[model samples]
Target: MAAHEMIADDLLAPAASADPHRVLATLREQDPVHWSATHRAWLVTRYDDVAAALGNKALSSDRVRPLLEARKSHDASASDRIRELLSEWMVVTDPPAHTRLRRLAGRAFKQQQISAMGERIERLVDSLLDEFVAGGHTDLIAHVAYPLPATVIAEMLGAPAGDRDRFRHWSDELALVAFGTGGQARPDRHERALRGLEELFDYLRSLVELRRTQPGDDMLSAMMVDDSSGEMLTEDELVGMCALLLFAGHETTTNSIANGVLALLEHPEQLALLRREPETITTAVEELLRFDGPIKVLNRWVVEDFDLRGRSIRSGERVYLVIAAANRDPARFAEPDRPDLSRNPNPHIAFGRGIHACIGAQLARLETRIALAEVVERLPGLRLDDGRPEWKASLASRSLTELTVAHDAAR
Candidate 1:
């Protein structure tokens, strides 16, 4: 709608980043599978199309070339950088290889493993809330949401807990790199971001290598020490996956917690609804994700000619699935706009759908639930000081920049 949101074509689409559903809904009604010359692809807004694209194993997530196309076929070097930085993670990988890497990550975050961390996660949430209690008021993002997920990632990766604070800095900056913050479309800031990422990878490699010899009770250890595989893992793959996990897992959940807090504070009816009916936490989390989803959009390159609802797309064509918009699809959710915490069959694509569904979704749910429950219980009358929340812009990921609030001042 505005000049800046015009960047919504950047994949992250900041213009639509703040309440993008409005724009997406219009697309769903008009073009359903309309092509946005801005994004240089077919923008899939309808729930069915978004679900189809997400489930279409044929549509590849690795879109370095499409990015070049989006850039008006400018520089081959930029194409390489986009492919190189994105190719390592499972998000950017394809088929058989993606399966294996996902399995490896799955082995590390196996349900059994995540289930065991329940108490630890609860304690972590409590400790974070303790700071809010001590400080009277806290910037939920800085003090809690941001740090907790980063800490969980460090633990998962077997990094020292003490480094969690600095890890937050690295993750935040790295996310800016992902979003190309400051409009770093060229080499300058882009190269620096990659360099910083390499440094992070270097640090993770050291730990991964150590786990090769002296193992710990962490995820990196699980991968390195997996006896079932009877094969050693590659360092590049390991670092890539970990870096992705940090960016994907940490930031998304951080945003979820921060955004969820703001939503709950503003919606006292929902806040009391959760407290009086704690069982609603599960459904409430789903609504929170829909109301303020962490991951707003997912992109894909349609490999083969495909039929999206009715619109047609040719091979090698690109498509963008507006998840935030689809979640509010009127056909899918009655009064799609309304944030009904108790909405049943909340079938939302917020965590995405199909093969690339967020691997850390359960972890995100655990983190957000714990954080919100703790905040509500500890901070009385926890409400947003500002009516409007500031959102972050990026190539991927959607979240609040800050969540200032005032409470009962209970120490």
Candidate 2:
């Protein structure tokens, strides 16, 4: 490897991007943590190193500055600027602010609170899947990916049932804009995403006022009674948090469900095994997440100088954990590339680990398990229909933009 490396172009274009397993495996085998000028971040491919980075709070998720520097190296582009604007959502915030906001939001996503919504999620998934049967041809992502989490988060936010489609549209734009293609921020797409977020905030702003006057079962009501000082979230924080949950909640799970289904279809033996033993659903879900996780990698900017993998990473430097790669690390699991539900003690960071572990993982697991099981049970001879699937043009959020599948009815 040269001292100054040219980031591979296969990585630049989403469709042309290297198969994540191959890239991760190569990095783990050679450079566990190597700085690539292309991405402008120290990419950590090894499991131990990736975990260490994810667990380090000293490394902030507030990435505006690092992104700024990365932009300087390039001639500048739409995608780069687009990423800069998406720094508002809580997912990008660092503590004590991140801690404060996450704690407040946790009130709404408590295990009991999230669990209580399961039956409704089941109904939502089953009802939509019912449509797939009647239509006989459906893009699982368009039909299911965008809906389940959209409806789930909307219900939690107390958004109007009529606005579900609108919410989905906005959420999709926001998700894409935030995770838009590599190099130079994509301005147009970024604006489009933020515009949707602005609209969502307007809706939530009014809802916040209403909650103040007359609280309801919605999470908005809970956020009003801030744990600290027993005061409600400031109007800005309230809107920011709402934007975060509605957007992040939907974005994270959508990819997992889409990616997980793709994995199941690709691995016929495991899919059949899952159908034979429904009890293995949980393990199967974990395997799918481990096999092809939703949140591929996490970003971090070093706040203080520290030694990482024998390399002298200075303050204000960038470090990224290639989670997708770590999950497939051979040392971490046997036959690392193989998707085996029988693989025990499979602890992978599909939802992430430590402070930022996905709060809604349990819900995501349930949504994925039920939706996948229903597909396997309902869609007969369901297999990848197209010669190749088209991947979303995003390095951060790995997903299929279109997955054509062949299917028949089970008589």
Candidate 3:
């Protein structure tokens, strides 16, 4: 296909391929701000353009409007419920609303609070590894990557331990809604996504009510009380924030762990480097994030007419910032295609940039750091079961459906 055709086609399908770097690189070079007829959004591929777009105040982050419009065409009731649920998400809002919501939830995710859970995370990692270490072979995603963050996030929210699996199910279904399927035009997928959204919202609401009556030493409890400014979150906003934390909390981290492991296994030298210089675990995690971050694309609507790279972006037009592409942009990083654990000054916007950057970034880094460190330390002989692994067909985020690995049983 021609460059423009490829750019205009369904970007998600090609992105799910084993290697999308070439396609992204081509677009970044040919047309950094090419409009996609397939997705009906402008594709911003270059690192500079993506970084700027992420921080551009002229680009509104209120995605709820478009989503509501899309839902309205098919299901009115579902749209109304979604609007109420998403209206309070800091990520989907702009300016004053986003500012207020971010401030209120930011306290609960403070460094001090997240850091205190380090030992707990470490123990959790150890226990998880203990369960599968003797097996010699297991699906890493199921045994470790998925459970670690899911458990931690559930505990942090004071959710019952028994309900972790159900949370995972809700998260998967909601993911289909948040990140469209390859065939979003299909009505069945839309219906399923809406069902998932409703179920997730109902579950979160019940949890919020429980916290209100019997608060505990958890982030949700912390968020319920007044802050230093004597401000409190409304019920809708509270549930929205909790849902955001619940989904965003585990989903991205789960992908990061799985993707990071895959990257390390593919590059044995880098894996060995990590084993030798364990201190580099920090930088290694950063490199892993840069190499293959979970989030692939983020959408922002143009609030006003703006000229980007000599092209005029009119108001109300959607812009899909290809984060995975930008991370591989040669203009920003040296040897952007290669995964170098020691690569410093890595300014990759994997988590995003500006005021709307990921709030749980520190926590994610902490989780990934601990998880990777434990993997290298405990399973020194670990290796991929097969050279080929399947990638989840997701446009918004990159993830592995499963990752099988084996280590020397004696080890």
TM per candidate: 0.89, 0.90, 0.92
Q: Candidate 1 lDDT, tens digit per residue, 1-411?
A: 644234334344556656566676667676676767776677777787788778777689776445544643554454456456666678877878788888877877783377777789999988887887787655777788878998988887778767777677778657645343333454555455666676787788787777778887788777664547665457778777778888888778887888788778778788889889888888999998987687667778777886756667888877777787788888888987767789888999889877788888888888888888888877877777777776655544566778887788568
Candidate with better lDDT, 2 vs 3 = 3
- For model 2 the local lDDT of residue 97 reads 70
The per-residue C-alpha lDDT of model 3 at residue 36 equals 80
Q: Better model by lDDT, 1 or 2?
A: 1
Model 2 spans > 4 angstroms off? 1-10, 13-18, 65-88, 181-187, 228-231
Residue-pair clashes, model 1: 3
The residue pairs that clash in candidate 1, if any, are 5-15, 8-13, 179-395
Best by TM-score: 3
Alpha carbon lDDT at 123, candidate 1:
94
Question: In model 1, where do residues sit more than 4 Å from their true spots?
Answer: 1-15, 64-85, 179-188, 226-232
Candidate of highest lDDT: 3
Query: Per-residue lDDT for 23-78 in model 2, tens only?
Result: 56666777777777777678887887787777786788887545655645543544
**TM-score of model number 1:** 0.89
Q: Estimate, for each residue in 251-308, the C-alpha lDDT of model 3 and write its tens digit.
A: 7998899999999999999999999899998888999999999988898888889998
TM-score, candidate 2, is 0.90
